[model samples]
Target: MYDFLIIGQGVAGSLLAWELAKAGKSVFVIDKGNPYSTSNVASGIVNPITGKRFVKSWLMDEIQPFSLKCYREIEHDLNVNFLSELSVYHVLNSVQEINDWSAKAATFHYEKYLSTSEIHYLDKEKVRNPNGCFEINGALKISASNFLSAIKNWLEAKYCYSEEVFEEAALNESRDFVEYKNVRAEKAIFATGYDEFFLKKHSNVKFSPVKGEGLVVEISDFFSENIVQGNVMISPTMAKGIYYVGSTYEWNFRDELPTESRKSELIERLKDTINCNFKVLEHVAGIRPASADRRPILGFFPNSRIGIFNGMGTKGFSLSPYFAKHFCDSLVAGKALLPEVDLKRFF
Candidate 1:
C-alpha cells in the first residue's frame, strides 16, 4: 500500500509527491501525459513585481525563498538542471509610471525585490522604450517543460509513475483507506490541472479556470536575457536566440485548441513588442485552474480520506514547492491549514 495516490503529474502533484516521498512516504502518480497541459506550456516566470501600479505580487516575500530552496533540492534529487535566477523588466508607460516605481523602490518592504532601475539588455532600435523600463530584482525564469519531464522520468524509474487517465468513478474509499484499481493507499490527492471532467465529481469545490495562449518564436536580432513584460512577456528559453512569447488570457474560451485568429493576434502583439525579424515556430494553448478568490486551495473534504492540493494557477512554479511542503508537513503533523487557503472556504 502506498501513502499517496496522486492524480496528475503536473507541478502541483509532482512537488507534493516529492515532498511525501522524501519524507519516507510511498506515492503513486497517474497522469494523462498531455504535452499541452497548462503546466507544460507555462513560461515559469516568477516575477516579484507586476501590473501597471508596480505593486508586489501576493506572498512574494514569503514564498520565494522557500520555493527556491525546494527547487534547488529537486534539481539535486532528480539530477536535472532547469532553474535559472534572472531578472524581469516591466515597461513603464510614462514618467508618472517610472516615478511610481521609484517611490516603491525606496520602501523597506520592496527594497530587496525592486530597486531604482534603468533599461538594460534591450536595443533602442528593437524595443520602443520611451520612458525607460524598470528592472525587477529577485525574478526567476525556469524551464518548466524540461523540469516537468525530468520529474516524470525519475518517478517512472522508481516505478511510482504511470501515463494514464484516472477515472473518478473507479476510486473506492472507506473509513480507513482509499483504493483505485489494484492500488491501495492510505489517502489520495487530486492535483490535476484544470480538469473539468474530474472536478465535476465534487460539486462543493469551485474552480475558475482561465484559458491562455502563447507562442514559441525564434528571434535572431533581438536578445532578452530575462523576461520582459510589455504587451506580453518575451522570456528567454534555454536555447539560443529562441524565446517564448505570449499570452492572451481569455476568461471564456470555447475550447483548448489554438485558433488562427488568436495566432494572428499574438503575432501582431509580438511585432508591437519588438522591432526585429522573428519566426513563429509553434502556437500553444491551455486552460489553467485559477480560483475565483485568486488564492491557492489546500485541504481535505469532510468525512473522507481524500484530499486536494491544487489551484496554484499561473504562479505554480513559485507557489507549489513551498505549499506542497506546507501541505505535506501539515498532514504528517495533523495540523490545520491556513484559513485563507483551506478548502473550507469554498465549502
Candidate 2:
C-alpha cells in the first residue's frame, strides 16, 4: 500500500506530495489537467503586506521564508527557474493614505516589510504615482503553472502520477486504508480546488468560491523590474515586453469564464495607473477555493480515511508550502495541527 494518494495537483497537493516524498513515503497524485485552473492563471504574486490598509499578511514571517526555501529546493531538483524575487511598489492614492503607511511603518512588526524611503517612479512619463508609492520587501512572483508542471513531470517519472478525474464512486474505504480504482493507500487527501462534489461530504467546512480574472498586456516603454500595484497589479513575466495585469474578484459568478466586463474594468484601471501604450494579449479566469473565515481548511474526515487540504485562496502561493509541511508532519509523524487551521473547528 502507498503512504498517501493525493487528488489534484494544484499548489497544495504538489507541495504536500513533495514533503511526503522527502519524508521517504510513497505518494501518488491524480490531476485532471484543467488549463484554466486557478494555479494556471494566477499571477503567483506573494506580498507580505496587502489590502488597502497595507497590513502584513498573516504569518508572513514564518510562511514567506519557508515558501522561498521550498521553491528554491524545487528549482534545484527540477533544474528549472520559476521563482523570481521582486520588489512590489504599492501606489499611494492620497496624502492620507501615505500618512497611514508612514504611521504603520513606525511599528516594529511592520518595519521589516514596509519601506520608509521615498518611492521611485520608474517611468515618470509612463507611470502615474501622484502621491508616490511604498516599497514592500521580500515579494515573490512565481510561475505557478511551470512549477506545477515540473512537479507533475517529477511525479510521472516516479510512476506515481495519473492524469485522470477522481470519481467519488470509485473510492472504497476500510478501517486500515482506502482503495480507489486499482490503487490502495493508507490515507487519501483531496486537494482539489473549488470542486464541491467531493467536499460536500464534509458539510461542516464551507467553501466560498471567488471567480478572479486576469489579463496579459504588451506595453511599450514601460521598463521596470519591480511589480507595480495600484488599483490593479501589473507584474512582469518572463516573456519580454509582456506584463500580467490583473485582477478582478467577483464573489458571485456564473462560471469560470473570462468576461468582457472585467476585461474593460481592468483596462480602465491599468490606464489610470500608467500612461504606457499597451494592447491586451490574453484574458483568463479561474475560481479560488476560499473559505468563510479566510483561513485554510485542513484535516481528516471525522470518521473516514480521507483527509482534505484546501482553501489556500488568493494567497495559495504564499500559504501552501508551510502548511503542506505542517500537514505532512501531522500525517506522517502524528504531530498536532495548528488549532486555527484544523478542520475540527468547523465540525
TM-score of each: 0.96, 0.98
Window of ten residues with lowest summed lDDT in model 1: 115-124
The candidate maximizing TM-score is 2
Which residue segments of model 2 deviate by more than 4 Å? none
Q: How do the residues 1-347 of candidate 1 rate in per-residue lDDT, one tens digit apiece?
A: 99899998888999999998888899999999988888998888777887678888888898887877888887898788888888887766677886888889889999888765544545668886666677888887779888899889989999988888888888999888999998899999899878888678876777788888899999877787888776778999999999999887788889988888888988898787778899999899888888778788898898888889988877878888878988988878766788888988987
Model 2 — which ten-residue stretch has the worst lDDT?
115-124
Query: Best-fitting candidate, measured by lDDT?
Result: 2
Model 2 / residue 262 / CA error / Å? 0.6
The Cα local distance difference test for each model comes to: 0.84, 0.89
Report residue 190 deviation for candidate 1 (angstroms): 0.3
Cα miss at 192, model 2 (Å)? 0.2
